[model samples]
Target: MQIRVSIFLKEKIQNPNGHFVLQTSGPVPYGFEVPGLIRYFNAKGQEVRRTRFPSGGNYTSALRQGSFDLSGDRVTILGTNMYNTPSSQEMDPSTTSNSTRKQKQADTTPNPLATEELNLLAKLMGGMEVQKILNVDAGFKVNLLALEQEEEGM
Candidate 1:
């Protein structure tokens, strides 16, 4: 079986309801800083696989999708979007280096989201077998298999 995941970044704004909300004004040109660990586990609650190395997942506009292969009746994928961590991974000076240090800067900018605060979404899937395909287009991006760059041909 095949699985796919897509991610995007949006800004949070208050809609005059005194509540903070995420809004997508239009197309975002920059890649999102999604550095962290991506793990795939089968129905038994054991790690079936994970990225060979931690990901420098700077989600780009490219195809906006990550694909993989798996076979199972059920699977639970845990995407640990590591942000504000104590140590930094091999990252490009452009993608996320500055995004984290700044506060939610402005409503016009799409800031990193700490899910515990609210909504959650990042395509994840796990099963007996996994092979990541990080087909990219213009900027930095990765899939479940992304270690450094992406396999555009995959």
Candidate 2:
């Protein structure tokens, strides 16, 4: 069955102005290679990003993390040991340094996940977590529930 996942940008974490929301459609199998996830900005045009599972890389340790970059717009998505960790933070443009720039280049390199981060992420992926589910209808109810169940199993 086909599925659609709503990737809501937190209110405080808006994408570059004029960019549309990222509503991913299709069955994203576990360890799926999310390629060229694009977001458009009025000022810069289009930006591209890669979203892939990082479970086998440095993230194999305690947590998993993934990375992505929206170069032209200066936006990056970094996560813990897991590719799509529960918590995310944006780099402040006001602060620039060698290490910071290096990290930006790395884009979505999985970062070491702390104990708390891992646990929180797990909970979020689990039913114990609460999220604002968007864009649901009778057709997708079953698929979404299955998706949630599948995610919790992970």
Candidate 3:
């Protein structure tokens, strides 16, 4: 299944009614964060999560959106509109230093996601609604089977 998610950052004044929302057939807005009030709608345009993650990440499970009041006259969201944590499997190349070695190891032993890991991911998504607010345009698809090797004799 796939979810179509669109994420944009705008000042509070830009979205006064807070009607810009994202929704998928499946539970998507789980594990997202919204500092202020937001109005997530269903296919029928009903309110879902009032708040959403302005900043996106992988590690922290939750992120806060940026806020700006029109009265201030000067409000800017700088340095990358979105934020996200690295996936658990993403290794730090700087520390490893040996890219070839890492590649070989990864190819030999493809770590399968444990049940607990899947549950945690589901919880994070459910809690933060990551998919609802995530930038689908930039998101990529992963094929778990591609990471595993097929047995010759079964």
Ranking by TM-score: 2, 1, 3
Reference-based lDDT, residue 38, model 3: 67
RMSD of each: 25.1, 19.7, 21.7
| TM-score, predicted candidate 1 vs. hidden true structure | 0.15
Q: Model 3: per-residue lDDT, tens digit, 1-154?
A: 3333333324222233445443222212225533334677999887876665443323232222323432211112234224433233333322323464456446555235453455456556544222333633322222233222443232
Best by TM-score: 2
Model 3, TM vs. native = 0.14
Give the Å shift of residue 113 in candidate 1: 38
Residues 1-154 of candidate 2 have per-residue lDDT tens digits of: 3233334344323354535544344323335444433344555665554344433222211112222344322322223223244233334332434575566557765455553465566566653443334843211111235466686786
In order, what lDDT does every prediction score? 0.35, 0.40, 0.37
Each candidate's clash count: 0, 11, 22
Question: Tens digit of lDDT per residue, candidate 1, span 1-154?
Answer: 3222222212223334344444333223334434355779999999998775554343334224322322111111223233322233322222333354343233235334443122212333312122334742222222456443455555
The residue ranges of model 1 lying beyond 4 angstroms of the native Cα positions read 1-12, 23-38, 41-154
Stretches off by above 4 angstroms in model 2 are 1-5, 9-89, 106-154
